[model samples]
Target chain A: MTKHFVSDTLVLLGRSLRHISRSPDTIITTAIMPIAFMLLFVYVFGGAIRTGSDRYVNYLLPGILLITVASGISYTAFRLFLDMKGGIFERFQSMPVARSSVLWAHVLTSLVANLISLVLVVLVALGMGFRSGAGVAQWLAVAGIMMLFTLALTWLAVIPGLTAKSVDGASAFSYPLIFLPFVSSAFVPTESMPGPVRAFAENQPVTSIANTIRDLFAQQQVGGDIWIALAWCVGLLVVAYGAAMAVYHRRTG
Target chain B: MSTDPQMTAERVRGPVIQVRGLAKAYKELHVLRGVDVEVARGSIFALLGSNGAGKTTVVRILSTLLKPDAGTATVNGFDVATQAARVRESISLTGQFAAVDEILSGRENLVLVARLRHLRDPGGIADELLARFALTDAGTRRVSTYSGGMRRRLDIAMSLIGDPPVIFLDEPTTGLDPQARLEVWQAVRELARQGTTVLLTTQYLDEAEQLADRIAILHQGRIIANGTLPELKRLLPPAKVEYVEKQPTLEDVFLAIVGDDGTDSTAGAASPAGTKNRGTR
Candidate 1:
């Protein structure tokens, strides 16, 4: 049964990918917003923020990547919304295919699209002198971490996609998600802020995650942040998975 | 339209759908209140109702899309909630609206469904269905650009990917033009001809009169009437005499019974426009 679901998910995942491919705008449109954010932050605002680093782009790249993911996940909800509104989900529900595969397909597609968007942002970042001497093992770790983060967010996207009342409502749920990283250490050091502001900024998931990824990229030894980051990723993944499944059951029950 | 109508309608020996005490309610509104129905195998069963009558709710429940607050319903002898996977495997639902992916071609949409259903050769199934639906020329065009009728045809083609034993169509012809509606009706008949049981929900009594062997009239969350066409019409009023040579249209009966503006077929047929009901089995 598990194998059937996996294979079916893979196939549906491919279908979603094909849809994405045909309309490259899904990824392109997603990339455009974060890319603009990266450009605007690194060139316009980078020199202004003091992170004790010579290059502001370096500090900003990590945050931009998170923004890319956040932005990309909205498309996940958008695509899922389109599927739901289009009645395609209803059509799938009637079929004998693994019921969960339908949801998994969208989740996996979100991961893939978000990854592509992440890579696009990274390529653009490299052009802006964002360099890392991080080794293959560290890079793989970054990939794994980012993938987990993406999965967590993607599953979170499923709930809004399944439950939202309108097209805008589905994608609107992701705005707060994308905006969260900006307030965290993704854009700057938490220490630079005041007491209360820094307290919330330092304790949030994005800060821990961005700090861990940035450390790995800089070849610096990642300490407690890595575990904290993983906890956040895994924790969100579990919670989102549970909520998505609950909503899915209610929607398709 | 073909030979042996009764034989085609009765091929499946047992009941295809069985429901008892099915109920669904929103936070404060009871959409379906203790509704019950049974659809015989291979029969084209039409569920008729006015807005808020819970016609689509019943289809959603039977198709495993919505949960019922209180009810026991089975499809192909498998309970909807417990045997959900089995129920899913046995049926296809073409909802009131078209659900094709805008970015993908009509053919690609069908192929995607075929692939999702784990068909041996997705391309072949897609190709066959596209041809069958007369959408071969439009197959390669992105669905976003397809006409409503074309999109609906592709949606129907997509639903047949698995060729499940039973199909649910919730207001399948609501927005379709007369030609498109006829095409859909023909498709429904074709599926039934191949021995697939169908549960159709619609406000168009003529559609019900044409497609269904058995009709159930849902009114205010209850099956106010249930039986064959003759039985249902009989339930309403005296059987009108139409010259055998000229069958009396529903318009004749409507004018005779309702006087003006007709019965509005719109009343109690579906939940008012966008106020969609939530259902589960």
Candidate 2:
């Protein structure tokens, strides 16, 4: 049974990936926005933004990575919405394959797609001079944070994908997610915000997550950001997972 | 994983689906009200209903996709609510549209589903299913390039990868030509013969007449009638049987009488048989 779940999930994941592979545009589309943002920021906004660092690209890359993931996940929701709308979900239900495998496959597909987009963004940042002296541990740490964040957001995406009445409803929910980084420490320091905004900027989950990634990339002391980031990621995962499961049960019940 | 026919045979004996007092409601809309249906070990049970009459809703509920507001149902003896994973494990579904990913080739789609079901040899299963569906030639072609019928066949084949017991087909062949519909019907029949209990929903009464052993008519969120074709015909107040040409078609008389709203003095004209129409809204 466990084998069935794993295998079925792999198959479905492949199916999802195939769709993504065919639409090379989706990956390219995902990479484009962040790449545009990265370049524009580095060349245009790079000098004006003060972070007490040698270059804004180094400080900004981490937050941009988070943005890439956030943007990439919207596609997850979009793909999931398409599948749901296409009646594939109904088709999978009749098979002897593990049911949860369907959702997990989509989740795994999101991870893979997001990873690719992240890599593309990172490569673009490198070309644009977003260098990091961090070693294997730091890279691994960055990857870990990105994956957890992806998982958390992916699960959250599941809710909208499953429940939305229309394709627009599903993908629209992700816009706020893409815009979230702007409010946090993604492009600018949270300390630079106005009094009321600063409190929210410092307290929001994305700030800690962005702070952790920035520190990890700069090879600076991560301090308590990593712990807070995990807590936030894990917490969102738990809540999103629980809510998604409940909604799934109610819908498929 | 187990390829033994005897094991497959044994798998067929168990009641693939069991339902009692199943009910579904959407805020003030009662979709399925106190519906009870039990599909025997390996038989085709068709639920006939109009567009909003809850055929897909019932199928969804049975396939472990939609939750019923009130009811007790099981797939392979697993409670749908509590044992949802098991129900999902035991069943497969094919809805209105071909759910195959257009970006992938038909073969890739099949293999993907195989891997998701945790099958041992995804490629082998994909090959067999392609052969069975006569899709081997088009296996490598991206689904986007395939015709509607091909996509539908691939979708059904995908559902069978794990050899699930209860398969829910919700208007599986909605937009197909006559030949394609025949192909799907042939597939459904073959599945029944192989001991798969199929719960099919169709707006096409001919499909129900041709495929179902036991038919349940759902109308206005409730079951108005349930029985065989003869039994359902018997319920229809002896509507003036017709003797047509030697090569008469079901469509000819169906259109003359059931299709029209009682202007022809021969249709028995009794308010258009409203209790059920299957998947039509």
Candidate 3:
């Protein structure tokens, strides 16, 4: 059974990857929003903000990467919703293939697409004179955190993908996620906000995640923020995976 | 997946598919209630019904996509509920709509299914099916670019991969033109000739009259009538022989006017050189 699941996942993965390769606009569109924000923040709003950093892009890169993933996962939901709408989901369900492989294939495709989008955003950051003093280990840690966050959000996206009535409904869930980083330290320091807003901003998942990635890039002590970020990612992943699987089985069954 | 010894022994005898008092219901609507059916091996069995009847529900339950609320169904002598994997191994489902990857080419779609079925030489299988379905010319083109009929043909071609013993076609010709419908009927006939059990569901009575060896009329979640065409005809009074003029159906006139000879003519219409290609082919 496990063997069939593995092989089936690889086959379906190849199929969806072909979809991504053919219409590269999904990845480009995913990267576009974060790139726009990065440009807007660094050029238009950077000098005015007091982030205690010489380059605002460096401080902003982590949040921008998160937004890139946030935007990219909507395509995951969109693609899965298309499959469900197209009747292909029923086709695969009725076949001898491992059923879980269908959702896994879509989730993995989202991961790969998001990785490419993240790289594109990073390249744009580099071009805009964004510099990181971090070494290879720091880069790997950052990559790991981004991937965990991606998987968590990707699984979360699967819920709407399965249950959405329309294409727009499938992707609309990401708007709040894209808006999440704005309220946190992603843009400005939480200290600058008023009482309740600052409390909420500092307590949310994005704040610790952004601070961790930011400290890593700056070669500063990550402190307890890294632990908090990892805990949030792992916790969200578990909850989202459980919820998504429940929804998947209920919908497909 | 170990097969039950009793099921293996039973596989050599009786019907290829059997359903005993199958029942299913949504929250407030009962879709199928105590439905029973048996399809003989290698026979073309049609579940005839109009829209809102439970034809699709039966197909879904038998194909292991849905579990019946009550009763049992076995395909290839394996229970659909308990031995779903084995039942799945023995059947392929071509859904009401063409369940194809629009982004992928025709050949890619075939290869994808073949690979999913764990068949060897997926490329060879895809090419063979493409040729068989007369889709070789448009095999490399994306499915989104193909006409509706061509897409249906590709959809059936994909289902043919691995050549499972039983096939379920849920209104395969619902949205097709006359010529395309004929091509699908021909493909189905070829499958029956090769000893594949076909369980087809459709709203069209003539399709069942033309294709099925046995027909079962499902209405209000029950089989109101079940028999061969002649037997069903005998259920009513014998036909009175009266002289009447036979007129050609709109389908015949449409096919004649289009001059479609089961070729891939409609597929070309979507391409830039469609007209030129049609003339040459």
lDDT of the candidates, in the order given = 0.80, 0.78, 0.88
TM-score of every candidate's chain A: 0.97, 0.97, 0.99
lDDT tens digits by residue: candidate 3, A1-253: 4569999999999999999999999999999999999999999999899999888988899999999999999998999999999999999998988989999999999999999999999999999988998999999999999999999999999999999999999999999999999999999999999999999999999999999999999999889999999999999999999999999888867
Global fold similarity of model 2 (TM-score) = 0.81
- Shift in Å, residue A94, candidate 1: 1.8
How does residue B143 of candidate 1 score in lDDT? 87
C-alpha RMSD over true interface residues, each candidate? 1.5, 2.7, 0.9
- List pairs with backbone clashes in candidate 3: none
Provide the TM-score for each candidate, comma-separated: 0.86, 0.81, 0.93
DockQ of 1: 0.74
- List the candidate 2 regions with Cα displacement exceeding 4 Å: A1-5, A190-192, A224-226, B1-19, B37-43, B67-91, B116-120, B162-166, B192-197, B237-281
Q: Candidates 2 and 3: which is better by DockQ?
A: 3
How do the residues B7-35 of candidate 3 rate in per-residue lDDT, one tens digit apiece?
44355578889999999999888889889
Which of candidates 1 and 2 reaches a greater TM-score? Answer: 1
Best-fitting candidate, scored by lDDT: 3
- Go through the candidates in order and give each one's DockQ: 0.74, 0.52, 0.78
Query: What docking class should model 3 receive?
Result: medium
Candidate 2 per-residue lDDT, tens place, B147-249, comes to 7777778888888888886688889878885445655776787777677778999877767877889999888877789888888887755332222111126
Off by over 4 Å in 3: B1-11, B235-248, B261-281
Ranking by lDDT: 3, 1, 2
Q: Which 10-residue span in candidate 1 chain B carries the lowest summed lDDT? A: B272-281
